[model samples]
Target: MTRLVAVSGSLRRESANTTLLRAAIALAPSDIAVTLYEGVGDLPQFNPDIEHDAPPLVQAWRALLRDCDGIVVACPEYVHGVPGAFKNALDWVVGSTELAGKRVALINASGRAVHCHAALVEIITTMGWIVVDQASPVIPVAGKNYTQADMIGNPALAQPLLAALHAMAGVPAMAD
Candidate 1:
């Protein structure tokens, strides 16, 4: 089984990015398991001095990334850049090898969030993760208030997401 961890860059209670990941979990094929990582908000600030003695949450976060075959990130742009909290979570593992050689799929919840998307691609690549271009898709769910059900039920949204999942899983995309 291919295990994938999905992360939402936003901490909002009703984040469209989170909703998109939830929809991804629902739409994933039986062979691919997409687990949503919800502990980003709980991680402490990045401290290079204390990285070796990392706290429990940081340890857990790194372990999750290490164990997963790949990661799916759905993020919303904040002030023309990646959100602070999400960037902080990444900083925790920046100096570690936990994510080295891992595959990554970036899901853009808003097409307007190009800045964050580019920044994320650069960050993920610099961290030694392979960014799957085929899996990175712009779904444009921003300001739509879209629910998981709405995304799963709509072919326009669902098809692209499924194709992304397939790409991450190394499964050939089925002919429509």
Candidate 2:
């Protein structure tokens, strides 16, 4: 099975990014398992002093990334940059070898979040991750109170997400 971890950069309870990921989970094929990583909000701030001896949460985060075949990130832009909490989560793994050569698919829930998306691409690329262009799509779900079912039901949102999952799985997208 091609396992992919989906992460939402927003920590908000009603985050559209998180909802988009949930839709991805629902739309993923059986062969491609999409697991949502919910520990970003719980992760402690990054500190270089404790790099070698990281806390349990950081360790667990690394382990998950190490085990997964790829990662799907949906992030929101804050003041035209990546969110602090999400950036902190990425910082914790910057020194580790877990993300080297890993495939990452960036899902943009808002079309206006270009800045954060670009920043994320730079950050992940610097960490040795291979960003899959086909998998990275701007779905534009911002400001809309979209439920998981709403996203899953709409082909406009679902088709691209399904294609993204297939791209991450290194497989050709099947005809619907």
Candidate 3:
């Protein structure tokens, strides 16, 4: 099975980004097992000294990132940039080999989040992640425009995004 980790950058209970992630999960093919990392808000700031022992929460996130076949990040822009909480969680993995050269997809749910998504892409690329070009299909206003449960029901955006994800998984994995 292709183990995919879907990380929702928003901590809000009713956040658009989180809803977008849920919709993605709902749309995923059954053979691909999806796990959602839902605790970014609890991760402490990254510090090398503290990392020597690695807090339990940080370790858990590191393990998840390490073992996943691929990753999907649904992030919402805050003040025209990536949210601090999500960035902090990502910062903890910088020094580890866990996520180096991993496949990642970035989904920007709202039109206002383009800059933030760009910034996040830059950061993730620098971290040695191979981001799929077709993954960002412009899912403008996932929550405000559509109900949280039906975010991925939009055929226009969902078709391309799902195709991108499956394409990233490729044929051999599917044929098996």
- Model 2, C-alpha of 97: deviation from truth (Å): 1.7
Model 1, span 97-146: residue lDDT tens: 85689999999989899999999999989988899999999998889998
- What are the RMSDs of all candidates, in order? 0.8, 0.7, 3.0
Specify the poorest-scoring 10-residue window by lDDT in model 2. Answer: 93-102
- On the 0 to 100 scale, the lDDT of residue 72 in model 1 is 97
TM-score per model over all chains: 0.98, 0.98, 0.89
Q: How many clashes does the backbone of model 2 have?
A: 0
Tens-place lDDT digits, model 2, residues 20-113:
9999998887899999999999999999999889999999999999999999999999999999999999999998885699999999999998
Q: How close is candidate 2 to the true structure, as a TM-score?
A: 0.98
Off by over 4 Å in 3: 142-145, 171-176
lDDT on C-alpha atoms for all candidate structures? 0.93, 0.94, 0.79
Best by lDDT: 2
Give the runs in model 1 whose Cα sits over 4 Å from its true position: none
TM-score between candidate 3 and the true structure: 0.89
lDDT of 1 at 117: 96
